[model samples]
Target: MKIAFYGSSLVSAYWNGAATYYRGLLRSLAEKGYEITFYEPDVYDRQKYRDMEPPDWCKVVVYEGTIDALKAAARQAAEADIVVKASGVGFQDDRLLEEVLGNASPRALKIFWDVDAPATLAELKSDPDHPLRQALFKIDLVLTYGGGDPVVNAYRSVGAAECVPIYNALDPQTHHPVPEDSRFAADLGFLGNRLPDREARVEHFFLDPASRLPGRRFLLGGSGWQDKPMSSNVNYIGHVPTRDHNAFNVTPMAVLNISRASMAENGFSPATRVFEAAGAGACLITDHWEGIELFLKPDEEILVARDGQDVAALIAGLSRQSAARIGARARMRVLADHTYAHRAREVDEIFRARLGARMEAAK
Candidate 1:
């Protein structure tokens, strides 16, 4: 299968969460014998911000110039077996959508793989000015990184021909327990970029817990969090490179998972961090969400916290033996059911279904 992935910064993970997701999925697809080409625009100083060099597993093509350049690039979409347009291309270019849908070959499968389903859906629902709302109907299939049944159903109701939830999963090879390092070792650690909508949730779930546990050290990693007023117990370490993520997770007593506001509101949207933490054999404390138990069994493979008090209580009560047990179980669960290989398989199945349907319609 020849697959062309159109997403934001597939070559650069620097401070972009979507970059890691794209790399994992594309690498997995390549392992499955798919010839993959990742098409990302050279925007946001992405050339300077690259974290991982293009893997030997697949090809990375960076598109330069204006919207017209991207439109010209869309001509390549004619040769692909599948063309995926992921959310957050980093620029507001409505023409990209029109070009992808209009220019794609009849044989090529067009997909809108939404990494940020909640935010996209919410914006489209409330705002008349949202650009991609009308474009959704043109795609053959819609896939989401997270957001369970509800999100899938909602997308379909809104004109998606079909919707599938390919939730975030672990890449065990990249994420596993490492020997404790003094730099990352802490009682609790939270890693995520700062966004306005997620700030309150961060304060409620992560920062508040650190404030309550003054004696225990808490570490913060991720971009755009420097100016925030953190408690004395919390130490901000700026951005941790994707390469060092496993080390960061493993060294912590317990890693914290905080969903963005849209994700929390939409439910079932676990960030890439959740899988990363689990894959690293790190005991995780996450804010409660409806479909969380589907991925990680609460109190068995994971711990759930509703608010600051819940988080503080969970941390204070977690014993070393208990934490180790939960961490092990979480890792086991991820390795068994939640890996990028598994996700790629799901995507392949969906593509087959869409292709079959198109053929049937033609006949």
Candidate 2:
């Protein structure tokens, strides 16, 4: 099968959180005999901060950030067996969505892949005239980053023919246990780009916990927050590149995962960092969410915290021995069940079923 995936960026993770997810899933899909072409617009300085060269698994088309260029890209993708427009492409997403669905071959399966389903659902609910809401009926399927039943139900309510949640999973080859570096050594570490909806939650789950545990060293790495006030015990390392993520995860005694407000409220939305940290055998302490057990067992493979107080207590009581044990268990659990290869198989099944049904109908 040929897949045309329009997304944020494949070569850069600079400001794009979905980069790893795309790489993992698509690489696995390519291994399954799918010819994939990823189309990313040359915007948001992503081309300037490219972390990776185009890989052999898929062809990358870095189009100019203009309407005419985008339309040409869309037309180029029209003949694929599956056409996917992912959310937050950092350009004229509305036009791209319309172009992909409008120009796609009648036999092609059109998909809207929402990386942030909770946030997208909130937009649709508040604004009846949202472009996605208006176009739902035309979409063959809605694939979510992960929101479990709530996200699926919400999309169905808005008229999606089918909705499925593809949760984040580890790409073991890309993320695995590595030797710890002193630079990232800390009691707890967190890496997430600052955004409006998640800043307050970061303060609650990360910043405040650092203040409460002043004796313990804390590390923070992300794009923004250079000016953000923090306790004297906190070490701020702005924008740790993708290459250093393994060291950042392994060196820290425990790594924290803070969900954006909408994701926490919606539940079942685990940030990519959660799996990355776990893949590196880093003990992960995450905020309370409904589906923690579905991925990792809390209080065993993972630790759950309700607020800053819980975070402080979890860190306070955690010993090096226990942290290592939890991390090892977490890594084992993900290796057994939540690798990208596992996710790719699920998606391949869906594609096969749909394509087979279409073939039967044609006969």
Candidate 3:
């Protein structure tokens, strides 16, 4: 099957949190003999700060987000079996969705892949006349990164034909145990782009913990965090590339996962960092969120902190042996059940079932 996917940026994780997810899922799909063409808008200085080179596995088209470019993408997408437009697409997202969904062929399966399900659902629910509300009805399927049943039900409630939770997963080849890098060494670490939605949680779970344990070291990684006021114990490593993720994970004594407010409130939304840390055999401590047990067994595969006090206690008291044991267990669980290959196969299964049902109806 041929699939055309439109997203923020496939080549740069500069500000795009879903870059790793796209690369992993698309690469796995390519390996499975499905032809894939990725369309990414060149915006937000993503092209200026390119991270990964073009992939040989699939065709990646970097287009200027303009009316002409939108026309070109629609033309290219028309020939594919499936056309996907992801949420949080940097520029002109609503226009792109309208054009793609309007022009999609009857044979093409159009999907609205919402990586930020919580935020999207919130917007749609809060505003009855949101543009996405109309766009949602035009799409064939709605897929999410997290939010599980709650997200699926929310989408359905908002006029979606079918909704599925395709939660983020690990790509062991890209993220696995690596020798520690001295530059990233710390007692606790947090890696995420600085977004308003998550900064408060970061302050509560990571910065507040750092403030509490001034003697202990803390590390922060990712873009958009420059010039921020942090505690003396906290060090910022701007924009750690995906290639160095394993090293970054191994260097930190225990990796921290702070969820965006929308994701936390919505529940079941695990950040990409969670799986990345687990895959690299790094002990994970996350802010408390509902449905976490569905992914990781708290106190076994991972640790959960309700506040700064809990974070400080966890960071200060966690032993090396216990960290290693928990990390290893988490890695094993993710590798067995949550991987790009697993997600890719799930997409295939969904398509197969839909096709079979269509054939049966025709007969």
Candidate 4:
């Protein structure tokens, strides 16, 4: 099967958090004999900060930041067996959405893959005529990286023919344990791009803890926090590239996963960092949210923190041996049940079933 995926930068994780998810899922899909052409616009300085060169597993089309270029890409993409217009393309997403749905082949399976389903759902709910809401009935399927039953039900309520949550998973080859780097050594480290929805949570869960525990080093790695005030003990390493993620994960004594406001509220929305941290054998301390046990067992494979105080307490009590034990268990759990290869099989089955049903209806 040929899949044309329209998304943010697949080659850059600079300001795009979905890059790893796309890379993991599409790489696994390619291994399953699917030919994928990922179309990403050269906007948001992502092209300048690209962490990866185009890989052989799939074709990557870095189109210019112009409506004409995007339209041309859409026309080319429509010829594929499956056409995906993912959320948050960082350009004229409204136009791209319309182009994909309007120009895609009649026989092609059109999909809206929402990486941030909660925010998208909120937009749809707030506006009766949101572009996605208006187009939902026409889309063959809606796929989300997170948000379990709530997202599925919401999509169905909005006239989606079908909805599925694939969830985030680890690519062991890309994210597994690595030799710890000295520079990233910290008591608790967090890596996430600074966004408005998540900044307060980061402050509450990550920064507050750093402030309270003045002696403990809290490492923050991501873009857009260079100017953000932080405690003297807190280390702000701006824009850690994709290649350094493994070191950043392994070197930390414990890694923190703080959800965005919408994702935490919606529940069942684990950011890619959760799995990435776990895969690297980093003891993960995550803010409380629903449905975490469905992925990682709390207090065993992962530690759940309710607030900054809880995070501080967890870090204070965590010994190197304990952190290693928890991290090892987390890695083992993901390796057994949450690898991208497993996710790829699930996606393949869903795609095949949908195609089978369509063929039957046509016959």
- Candidate 4 lDDT over 258-301, as tens digits, reads 99999999999988989999999999999999999999999999
Q: What global local distance difference test value does model 3 have?
A: 0.88
The CA lDDT of each predicted structure is: 0.84, 0.94, 0.88, 0.92
Candidate 3's residue-wise lDDT over 1-363, tens digit each? 888898988888888899889988889888888888888888889988888888999888999868888778867877888889999888888888887777777777889999999889889999998888977767888989888888989899999999998889998888999898999989998899889998888888898889999899999998878888899999998988888889999888899999999999988888888999999999999999999998899999999999989999998899888999999999999999889999999988887777677667768
Q: What TM-score does model 4 achieve against the real structure?
A: 0.98
Candidate 1 C-alpha lDDT tens digits along 91-143 = 54566766777877877888888899988887677865556768776787888
Return the TM-score for each candidate structure.
0.95, 0.99, 0.97, 0.98
Clashes of each: 0, 0, 0, 0
Q: Clashes in model 2: which pairs?
A: none
From the highest lDDT down, the ranking of the candidates is 2, 4, 3, 1
Pairs clashing within candidate 3: none
The reply for model 3, stretches above 4 Å from the true place, is 359-363
Which regions of candidate 1 fall more than 4 Å away from where they truly are?
127-130, 360-363
- Candidate 2 structure quality by residue, lDDT tens digits, 1-363: 899999999999989999999999999999999999999999989999999999999999999999999999999767799999999999999999999888888899889999999989988989999999999988889999999999999999888899999999999989999998999989999999999998999999999999998899999999889999999999999999899999999998999999988999999998888999999999999999898999999899999999999999999999999999999999999999999999999999999998889889999
The residue pairs found clashing in candidate 4 are none
Better of 1 and 2 by lDDT: 2
